[model samples]
Target chain A: MEAIILQILNGLDKGSAYALIALGLTLIFGTLGVVNFAHGALFMIGAFCAVTLQRLLNLSHEVIDDTKKDFLGNPLKVDVPYLADWFGADAAQTIIQWSVPLAILFSIPIMILVGISMERGLIKHFYKRPHADQILVTFGLAIVLQEIIKAFFGANPIPTPAPPAFTGSFDFGALIGMENIIYPYWRMVYFAFAMVVIAGVFAFLQFTTFGMVVRAGMADRETVGMLGINIDRRFTIMFAIAACVAGLAGVMYTPINSPNYHMGMDFLVISFVVVVVGGMGSLPGAVLAGFVLGILEAFASMNEVIDIVPGINQIIIYLVAIIVLLTRPRGLMGRKGVMEE
Target chain B: MLGLATKDFVLLLVVAVLCLFAPVLLNPFPETSDLAQFNAGYPDLMQRFVIFGIFAIGFNILFGLTGYLSFGHAAFLGVGSYSVVWMFKLLNYNIVPGLLLSLVVSGLFALAIGYVSLRRSGIYFSILTLAFAQMSFALAYSVLTPITNGETGLQVYGNDPQYLQGDSAPNIPHLFGMTMRATETVEFGPWLWQFNAGYYFCAVVMLIAFYLAIRIFRSPFGMMLRAVKSNQQRMRYTGLNPRPYTLAAFVISGMYAGLAGGLMASMDPLAGAERMQWTASGEVVLMTILGGTGTLIGPVLGAGLIKYLENILSKINDNILHQWFAFMPDGLEDFLVAIVHPFIGKGWHLTLGLVFMAVVIFLPGGLVEGGQRIGRLFGRKKPAEAEAKAAAKTPAE
Candidate 1:
């Protein structure tokens, strides 16, 4: 029972990411009607923003320390970072420790700019084109973006540590009267952070006037346009919001599984599957499917199943997708007339 | 009209003769020369020109004609490859059974996929196909590892039960009695040209495929596909269901991919999951689009151009750039070479991307349109002006 609960906990952070990305994808599809294949790349760019911030914070002037050479080293450099100079050594360490969360403030504006430019510059032209053309062009853009990232950052995964305060795990076995059951603190922190973000998004969408208007536009863009609501502008803003959401998810995800150029590619296909299984243009469906699939995947990875059927872990999610698609076609909450051609 | 067509046919025959003896005709130049590179009658490159030509030609039947873009056609190809490999593993190395099995298996898979995928049109269809393809890929990588051999792929084992033939002869796949890579090299001056047996076999198959494609293009079924492309609702209202025709086209295209896959494995005898990735499917689409989608011969040219460039561009390096730059004034040459260097060698994809963008933006009808434009430009005036003049001459009637 404890093991199952621990597995469920382990699945939540991943589930949160899947939900966040699928939510954004569905949001864009529901409103703009563009597939937005570059969403994954946008997520990647968001993580890189955190990496960029960390790099910027650590920028230093190198000084030769002749006295510090030891154990076959030629020379030692005692560097002083700009952050250390500005905030003093201990405070700079702390600031750098919390730089990932701090990056949200920095990444939001940058991602928004990127999102707006992407929509206005490239995607705007493709809106009237066939879905195949849209998919091809966006796929091309994704390849270009990934290659650019590779050229700059190389192919290796870069590790980003959580803050020093959240580096340990908490014992849950004692609480449950079981031995040797513990959950990582960072994971729990990740779950709370995800909830906060999700709640904030929900609140913004459900309560705010802008959110209400956006929802209204999603339901009937023609009516919104007829009302002189500038539906296009709101749709563009929604694209930015979607991009930022994916980006923020990436930023938070860095500590869980190091960031790399092709990390987005690894997730892109599965996320698309998630979106399809959820329902192409349904937000709540995406959220539900994400958690359900995440838990299913966790269970599938367990030792008991592999003994019965080898390599089930790799295929369980896809098998689930196929079954759902065959039965539901529109997915769990899909409405008619969306992809009916 | 008969006289004009006869004249064109004779001209075509003469061009074909020239193409057959191209290596001998262009022997004055080194094989590595740009002109020779274009004209070289090497069997390997020629084989590829035909094989991928067949693949793209088949793809255009479904995508270009029917406007149903499948992003998972490579799954059929992978299935074909695996089937052929399995045939080689179990039975004699004769390509007859392997090829037959490839076609049958891929066709069946396509039938299943098309049935479900055709249920949803547009993006939904595309996503469904993608999901199925990924499912196949995952299964091949993990669950079906015993059959596919997972990441390392399948290799030939000499000792096996000869299912059909008696003992003393080993059961291994072969084309009659000849080796797949059997080739004869001819030397002239400093150039060496190879005439590979397997390549000629592929060439013959490609010609047959081309002929079949032409037949399909002119058939009544092809007309129905075009109608479906124009407006499916109109077709449906006319008491004609487009599903069977589209599904047939899908299956035929899948068979073509399977044949290509079988040929690949026959030549190399390895099957892997990587070939079934979405990227491979996209590549065929790219080739079809780059050459000319709706045209019969355009896809062949597109496949040849991309494959040739892929092979050649990967060979360029900084040393090659430096050598070319050595003829100019030292500083000036270095600067110019530096500017061009990044776009070559390991950066071939950057050049390919720019070319793709150019093709998409300008030559939307692909190389076929580009050819017609050039022909018109030289014949009388600018192509656009000539087109206007032709439009005036023809009238609506």
Candidate 2:
């Protein structure tokens, strides 16, 4: 029972990432009718935003300390961060410590701008083109974006630590009347964060008049346009919103896995599998499948399962995707005629 | 000539001449020239050009004709390589049997994948194929390590069973007694050219593959495949089954990829799981689109262009950039070199991405359309009519 609960907990964090990325992907596909291959690149840009903020806060100038000798027997050149000089050492240190959370604010505007420009500049022209062309163009865009990141950052994963307050594990065994059921605090925080974000997105779409019109537009764009609604403008805003969600997910995920240039690509194909399994344009299904597959993957990775079938964990998600696709052609919640042909 | 149309005969002859004298044609620079680094006439690169040309040509047959965008074709290539390596391990060092086995194995693999994937059309089909390929790649990297040799790749050893081998059996892959790596260099004046046995062997195979692709393009079966691409519903209403034709095209292309893979293994005698990655599959797709999808010879051109760029452009470092801009003023030279530095060498992918985007957006017919447009610009024909014709020819969907 404890193992099951632990596996579920383990699955939740990975599922959160998959859900967030798939949400963005489905949103773009739902609203703009585009398969944005560069969506992963946007998520990558979000993680880098946190890295950028962290680096910015830690911008240091050299200070010679006569008390400490260097390795070469000279006076030690202790680097004092500019933030420490300006805001006093304690406050600047605290701010730098909380850079990951702070990056949410930093990434929002940047991600929106990127989303808007991507929609306006390159993807706008491709709206009428074939899906193949869209995929090709966006794939090209993805390569360019990833290569640009690689050039700037080099190809290494930069570790970004979480705040000291959330570094350790929480012993849930005592509360649950079970032994050794400890879970990491940051992972629980991530799960809570994901829940809030998912709920917020659903509430926004359900409650707002703007969202109602957008939903109507998704169902029938031409009819909504005939009723004189500016659906295109709303859809573009939705695209930006989707980009924000993906960016926020990336920002928060840096503490879990160190941010790297190719990290987006690592997530991209799997997220694509998640999207397909969830049914092409179904948002709820995307979230549902994400968690389900995540748990399935966790279970598959267990020693017992590996003993039964070696290397099942490496291919479990894809195997599930294939089986699901073959059996359920429209996916779990997909509407007919959306990419059915 | 050879029962082909006049245009096709001329094209074949041109291609033949080009392949036969590629060493001389590809190496225009003198032996000691500074531009020698740019020459791609060496055996390794030349072999790659034809091998990848074969791969791309096969991909074009399926994608250009059917408009079914497969993202798992490289799996077949990997399968071919693995099968050939196994043949080399178990049998003698002869390439013929290994190549044949590669075709059979990959063809069977393709048949299985295509049968299932072809059930769904459009993007779903693409996803299905991608899943299969990813699964295959994962297996090859992990549990199948006994067969695939995992990250180190599958290679031959001295103790491996070679039942057909004699006392003097060559360790390297060969056709009869001739080694695949055998090369002869000839010098004319200041120019030097290398003639490689492996390259010629691959070039001949590439020509044959190209010829088969041309025949397929002109055949009635090809027309049926195109019809399926244009409108499957209409074809179904006309009482024609599109599945068989599509499956056949898929298998044929898979065999071609397998052949290319076998050739690759024959040249290097190793098989790595990385060859089956989706990125490698994307490379072939990029080659086809960049070269011009539907046109004959376009895929080969695309393959050669990409391979040449990959080999030559990647060798240009910061020093090379600085050297090129040394004639400028100090500040200007530094600025120019710095600006040009990132998009070369390690940053070649960025340049390639930008080029690919430009091709897809501006010239949907790829380089062929661009060339046609330029040709029309020089001629007396009105540009508007030519533009319309070109637009009409392109399958927009």
Candidate 3:
């Protein structure tokens, strides 16, 4: 029971990331009718935004301190962060500690601009082109984006810590009357944050007029356009919103997995599988399948499972996708004619 | 001659001659010249040029002729390499049996994968193949470590039992008694040319492959494959089952890829899971597209161009860049070097991506189309009329 609970908790954090990215992918697919291979790059860019903000906040100036001795026994040149001097050292320390969350605010405008520019510059010309062309161009774009990031950040994974308060693991075993079932506090925070974001998106689509039109446009673009609605403009905004969601998910994911240039590509293929399994162009389906696959993946990686079938975890998701695709070609929640051809 | 049309016969003769004398043709620069670095006459690189040429040609058969874009074809290549290595480990270090086993194994693998993946067409087919390949790669990397030797790659060891090997048999891969690494260098004046047995062997195989590809391109079977690509629904309605034709193309192409893989192993005698990665698969696709999808010579050109860039262009470092720009003013030279720095050496991928994007966007027909456009600009021939004549020549219903 304890192991099962622990696995479920472990699954949720990863599932949250999958759901967020899959949600964004499905959004772009649904609205733009595009297979955006660069969606994962957006998630990567978001994570880098957090890294950049952390680096920026911690920018240091050299100070010679006579009290501190260097390795050679001379006066030590201590590098003190400018933040420590500008704000009182305590406030600056707090700000630095909360850099990951602060990156959310920093990444939003930047992500939106990126989304808008991508839509306008490259993808705009590809709308009327073949799906193969779109995929190829976006794939090229993904590579260029990642290579650019690699140029700036180097190839190594950069560790980004969460706030001090959420760094410790919680004694979930005591709460549930099971010993030795500890879960990280930040993971729980990530889960709650994912829920809020998911709820917020769902609410935005359900309660707002703009989202209603966008949803309507998704269902029937031509008819919406016939009703004199500027569906294209609204869809562009929807694209930006999707980018923001992916970005936010990436920003929070830094503490879970260190930000690396290739992290987006690693997730890209898996998220694509999630999108396919969830049924293409289905938002709720994307979310549902994301969690389902995440849990399945977590279980597959268990030692008992590995003992039965070694390396099953590496391939279980793809196996499931193949089976699902072969058996139920439309995916879990896919519409009849969506990418059937 | 050889049952080919006059034009095709000429093309074949030209290609054969090119392959036969590539050492001299590819090495235009003298050994002592400043431009000597541009020469691609080395045995290793020449072997790769032909080997990857074979790979891209096979890929073009499936992708160009049938319009079925496979994203996992490299898995077959990897399978071929592994089979050949296993053959070398168990049997003698002869390439003939190794190559044959690789073709057979990879063909069987392709048959199974194609049977499932071909059930879906278009983007779905691509994704399905990708999934299968990724699964194969993942399995090879982890659970099959005993066979694949995990990250260190599969290699031969001294303890391996070679039942067919005699005490005097050479350790390196060979044809009968002739070693693959055997090379003869001929120097005349300032020019140095090397002829390697392995390169000649690969070049002969490539010529045969290219000839087979040409025969297939003009065959009724090729026409059917093209019909499937152009309109599968119409072909189905006309009482032709496109499935078998597509499956056959997939398998044939898979065998070609396997052959290439076997040749690779025969040259190096090692196999790694990275050969089966999706990126390697994408590299083949890039080669096919960059050269021209449906053209006979395009894939080979694409393969050669990409291999050249990867091997030669990536070798250009900052020091080379500075040296080349030394004639400029100090500030201008520094600026030029800085601008050129990121697109070479370790940054070659960025340049490749940019070039790929440009080709996809502007030259959708690939480098062949660009050539055709230039040809038309020079008033060599009326392209539309020539296309019509070519279409009329083909016995398409």
Candidate 4:
């Protein structure tokens, strides 16, 4: 039982990422009626935002520390970050340590700007095009985005560490009178962060007039236009929001998995599977599917399970996707006439 | 002339001429020239061009004619490669059996994948194919280690059984006794041109594949496939089952992909899991779309252009850029190199991506259409009307 719980816990962080990305993808699909393949690139850009912040915080200058002399010499040269000069050394140290979290704020504006520009400049033209063209064009965008990222950051995975405070694991085994049920504090934080964001998005959509209009627009774009509502503009904003959400997921994800240029692509196929399994254009379904698949993948990877099935973990999600797609073509919660054409 | 319409026959002849003389044509620069880096007349790269040409051509048959965007096409390519390599491991080093085996294996594989995936249309079909591909890749990488040789990839080892091995047989892949890597270089003036056995063989195969594609494009069955693409529901309303036609196209394309894969292994005796990755599948899609999705020669052109660019652009590092701009002022030269930096060397994908996006956006018809548009600008007649005239005179030709 403890082992099972531990597995579920292990799954949550990855699940949270899938849910976040799929939620964004579903939003773009539901509102704009566009299949945004570059959504994964948006997540990657978000992770780089964290990397960017760390780089910014660590921008340094060489200073001569007369107090600390080198073996050969007059004065030891010390590299001092500009942050240490602006805010004292202790504050600068803390800020650099917490740069990944701080990147959340940094990436939001950048992600929104990117989303807005992407929708306005490129995807807007493809709205009336076939889904194939949309897919191809967005796929092109994804490649360009990742290539640009690769050009800037180089090909290596940049390890973005969590704050010193959350480095250790939280023991849950002792609480339940069990052994070895400990979980990482950062992972738990990730799950909580995901829940908060998911709730925030739901609440924003549920309680606000803007959300209601967007939802109605998704239901009937023509009807919404007849009502004199500028559905297109709202959909564009929604695209930005979705991009922002994906970006946040990436920003938080860096500590869990090192932020590589191809990380977005690595997650992309799995996330697409998540969205398909959840049901295209279904927000709640996307989230639910994400968590379920993540946990299942965790279970599938277990040594006991692998002994029986042999390499089931590597393909369990795809297997489930195939089975689900064959059985339930509309997905777990897809609406009618969404992508039938 | 091989039952082709006069216009298509002319196009076929032109393609044949290009393929036949590629070694000479591609070696436009002298060996001693600074532009030597741009030459793709070598065996390995030329093989890739033709192999990928065959791949894109096969892809075009499905995606171009049927409008089925299969995202897992590389699965067949990988399967073909594995079959060929296995043949090498078990049988003789001759490529004949391996290539034939590849086509058969990939065809069967495609049939099975298509049977299930064709049940859904649009995005679902694509996702299904992708899922199946990822599964195969995973299996090949891990569980199928005995067959696939896992991460190290399947290769001929000293201990491996070679039932058809003989004292006279060459160890490398061959067509009977003629090794695939056999090359003859001729120097005329300062230019050096290579005539490679493998490239010529692959080029011959590509030409045959191209001719067959042309035949398929003009046939009544091809029209039916096009009709299916335009409106499957309408075909169904006409009391026609489009499934068999689609499944047939899928399998045909799969065989073509497998054939390409087989040729790849024939050129170089190694097959790895990466061959089945979605990115490899995406490359064929990129080639087909970038060339011209529905056109006869678009995929070939796209494949050649991409492969050439990959070979040439990747060699243009910062130093090369600096050298090219050396005649300018120091600051200007440095600035130019910096500006050109991101689109060359390791950054060629960025340029390719941007070009792909532009092609999809402004010129959806691809490079073939782009060529037609340029031709139209300088012509006395529109090609569409000329095509009608040619069709009228087709019986005589």
Candidate 5:
């Protein structure tokens, strides 16, 4: 029982990420009707936003301290961050330590601009084009985006840490009257953050007039367009929101898996699977399927499962995908006629 | 001549001549010149150009005609390679049995995958194929380890049966007794040309593949494929089943990819799981698109161009860039090198990405159409009439 709980816990963080990215993919597909293959690249750019901010905070000049002496008996030199000089030293230390969370605020505007520009500049022209053309063009865009990132940050994974307060594992086992249930505080924080963002997106879409219009547009785009609503601009906003969701997912994800140039591509294939399994253009389905697949993946990786299947862990998701795709063509909760053609 | 219409026969003849004289034509530079680095006439590379040309050509048959953009074609390529290497392990180093076995194996694999994947169209189809390919890759690295040899890759082991081995047989991959790596170099007045046995073998196979592709393109079945691409529903409404034609195209293309894989192992008898990766599949797609999807000769040209760029552009390090711009002052030279550095060396992918996006954006019909446009632009002597004639000659699609 404890082992099962541990496995579920293990699955939550990864599942959260898949859910977040899949939600964004579904949102864009729902609103714009353009399959954004480069959405993964947007997730990647958000991770780099954290990396960029950390680098910005760490920018420093050399300082010589007369009080400290080196082995040569001369005044010792220290590197003082520009942040430390502006804010107090302790405050700057705290800020740098919390750069990952602070990056959430920093990434939002940047992600919005990227989202708007991507939809307007490139995807706007591809509306009437065939889905194959959209896929090919967006795929090309993804490669270009990843290559540009690789040029800037090199190919290595950069480890970004959580805030100092949330760095250690908390005793979940003790709290729940179960031993061996310790989990990282950061992971719990990430899961909570994901839930909050997903809820926020859902609530926004469910409650507001903007959301209503977008939903209407999604159902029958022509009717909404005929009603004098600038459905195109609302859809653009919807694209931006979706990009923001993917961006926030990336920002929080840096602490769990270090940001790398190819991290986007790595998650992309899995997230695509998630979206398909959830049923394209279905938001609730995306979340449920994401968590479900993630948990399934976790269970597959367990020693007991591996013992039975030999290498089930390596291919469980794809196996599930192939089975689902073959058996249920519309996916778990796909709308009628959506992507049917 | 071989049942081809006049224009196609002319195209075939031109390709035959080009293949026959490739070693001479590709090696434009003298042996000792600094420009020798740009020459792609070497056996290793020339073999790749033809092999990948075959890959893209087969891919074009399905993608160009049926408009099914498969993302997992490389899986079949990998399967073909494994089959060949297995044949090499059991039989002698003869490529004939292996090649034939590879074709059969990959065709079966494609039939299975295509039957399932063809139920869906557009993005779903692509994802399904990608999932299948990734699964194959993972399986090759794991459960298929016994057959694929896992991370170390599949290769010939001494303890293998080799039941057909004879005393006169060459140890390396060979056709009866002619070794694949055999290169006869001819040097004359500061110039050297290589005539490789393997290249000629691959060139012959490619010509055959090209001929087969052209015949298929002109056949009634090819017309049906085009109809499927243009409007599958309409065709179905006309009381014809599109599934069999599509499945056939998929299997044929799969056989093409498999043949390419077999030839690769024939050139160098090693098969790795990496051959089935998404990137490998993407490379074939890129070649098909960058050349021209529907046109017969486009994929070959694209494959050669991409391979050339990958080889030559990646070879240019900062020092070469500095040397090229040494005529400028120090700062300017340094700046030039710095500017050129990222797009070469380890940064070749960036250049490729930019070029790929540019092609997808501007040249939807690929290099063939681009060439036609350029030719029309230059031939200002009654451009309208010539343009109309050129348009008439192009496919009806």
Candidate 6:
């Protein structure tokens, strides 16, 4: 029972990431009908936002004491960060605690601009081309984005600490009657934050007239156009929203997995698999499938199962995807006529 | 007509001669000059040009002729490399068994993957192939680490158990009693050029592969493939099964990929999971598409161009650009060098992207069409030439 609960928690955090990425992917697929392979890169850019903000906030004023020297004749110096000087010494040292969450505001505009530019500049031309061309072009875009980031950031993962207040684990052993049942506070925070974002996105889509129009456009773009609506403009906005969502996910993910240029690639494959398993263009299905796969992945990685199959944990997701694909061609919530000729 | 035939034959002969003497032809500066590194007209680059040409040619057969874009072809190439390395480790360093095993294993693997993936079409087909490729990559990295040697890649030590060659085998096996790397260098004036045995061996194989490709291009099977690409539904209505033909094409391409992989392993003696990544698979697609997918000779040109640019552009760092602009004023030189610096050296991808976009926009029929367009612009030629050029310019039905 304890193990199952623990696995569920593990699953939820991972599922949150997958769900967020897949949701964005589905949104792009739904609204624009363009499979944005560069969505992962957008997510990566978001994580980099946190890294950048931390670096920017940590920039310090160096004070060199020419009168002081070490045994090796090195100069002694004291550096004071701008944040520390402004807020206080204690506050300046703990700026990462604030800057990480603040990155959401910093990343949103940049991500939106990137999303808009990408849609208008490159993907706009590829819309009429074959799906293969769209994939190739977007894939090329993804590579370009990743390589540019890599050139700037180098290949190393930069660790982003959560705010000092949310840095520990919550011990659930007392309530559970188990010796140890500890869950990381940051992970719990991540789950709740994901829920809030997911709720916000769902509410924006469900309640607004914009969502209805976009959904209608998704069903039939020609009919929407016939209704004297500019579906393309709405689609571009949705793509930007999707980029923001991915960016937010990336921003929050930095504390869990240190931000790196290649992190997008690692998540992109799994998120793509998640999208496929959830059924292409199905938003709600993407969310459900992400959590399900995450839990299953958690379970597969357990010692007992791993001891039997060695690397079953890594292969299990693909095996499951293949099985799901073979059994349910349209996926769990896949609509009819989507894959139909 | 005799004159036309002679011209065509001479054109091909000239290209062959140019490739054969590329080291001499590409050497712009004398060896006695201070800039020796710039004159890197070595065997490695030459071998790479031919090897990637083979890869792209094989990829073009399936993608260009059949109009089936595979996103997992590199898995076969990686499999070929791994198989060859294993052969060297377990059997002997002899190239024959390794190459043969590479072809067989990769062909069989492709047969399995294609059998399932070909059931779908368009985006689904691409996704299916991509999934399998990722699976292969992941398995090689983690699950099959014993076979693949994980991230460090599979390699062979000198003290490997050679069952076939026994105690008589040399450290590096010979081809018909000829050393693979044995070469004679001749110095003429200020330039030194080497005629490498390995390069010639690869060149012979490449020529054979090219001949085979040309035969396939003109065969009845080739016509059927074109018909399938034109209208699969119509082909089905006519009681013709496109499945078997597509499968055959897939297998043949896989074999070609395996051959390329085997040659790579033979040249470098190592294999890694990175070779099986989707990026590598995508590269062959770029080569085929950029060069001219359906055209017989387009892929070779595309492959050679991409590989050559990768080698040259990667070596042109900021310092090299600065050196070129040294004659200008200090500020102006710095600005000029900085402007050109990003497009080369780590930023070569930006150039590649621009080229890809240009190709997709203007020359959809590829470099072949570009060539014909240039030819037409030069002035009036033979009526047959004009007509042939017109037909080539038209996108495949």
Task: Give each prediction's DockQ, rounded to 2 decimals.
Answer: 0.49, 0.88, 0.78, 0.86, 0.77, 0.46
lDDT (10s digit) by residue, model 4, range B349-397 = 9999999999999988787767666656777666443432332221100
The residue pairs in collision within model 3 are none
lDDT of 4 by residue, A1-341 (tens): 98799999988889999999999999999998898889899999999999999999999999999999989978999999999999999999999999999999999999999999999999999989988899999999999999999999999999999999999999979888899999999999999999999999999999999999999999999999999999899999999999999999999999998999999988888999999999999999999999999999999988999999999999999999999999998889888888865
- How accurate locally is residue B389 in candidate 4, as Cα lDDT from 0 to 100? 30
Q: Which runs in model 6 stand beyond 4 Å of their true positions? A: A63-77, A173-175, A339-341, B1-15, B33-40, B166-168, B381-397
Off by over 4 Å in 1: A70-75, A172-181, B1-29, B32-45, B162-173, B327-342, B361-363, B372-397
Off by over 4 Å in 3: A71-74, B381-397
Between candidates 3 and 4, the TM-score winner: 4
Better of 1 and 6 by DockQ: 1
TM-score of chain A of each: 0.95, 0.96, 0.97, 0.99, 0.98, 0.94
lDDT agreement with native, every candidate: 0.78, 0.90, 0.90, 0.92, 0.90, 0.81
Q: What would the per-residue lDDT of candidate 2 be over residues B106-184, giving only the tens digit for each residue? A: 9999999999999988888888888899999999999999999999999999899888987786779998878999999
Model 6 over residues B139-160: C-alpha lDDT tens digits?
8998799899999999987687
The CAPRI classification for model 5 reads as medium
Best by lDDT: 4
What is the TM-score (0 to 1) of chain A in model 6? 0.94
Weakest lDDT window of 10 consecutive positions for candidate 5 chain A: A129-138
Q: After superposition, how far is residue A280 of candidate 1 from its true place, in Å?
A: 1.7
* lDDT (10s digit) by residue, model 1, range A263-328: 776677778878889988888888888888877877778788778977777777778887888789
- Please give the range of 10 consecutive residues that has the lowest summed lDDT in model 1 chain B: B388-397
TM, every model: 0.89, 0.97, 0.96, 0.97, 0.97, 0.92
Instruction: Kindly report which residue stretches of model 4 are placed more than 4 angstroms away from their true locations once superposed.
Output: B381-397
Fraction of native contacts, model 6: 0.32
- What's the TM for model 1? 0.89
* lDDT string, candidate 3, B88-120, tens digits: 999989889999999999999999999999998
Residues B1-397, candidate 5: write the lDDT tens digits.
8988876777777788888888989999998998888898889999999999999999999999999999999999999999999999999999999999999999999999999999888889889999989999999998889999999999998898999999889999998899998899998788889999999999999999999998999899999999889999999999999999999999999999999999999999999999999889999999999888888888898899999999999998988887789999999999888888889998898888888888888888788778777767777545333322332354423
lDDT of 3 at A204: 96
TM-score of candidate 3 against the unseen true structure:
0.96
- lDDT (Cα, tens digit) per residue for candidate 6, span A147-182: 778777877999999987778888866776885679
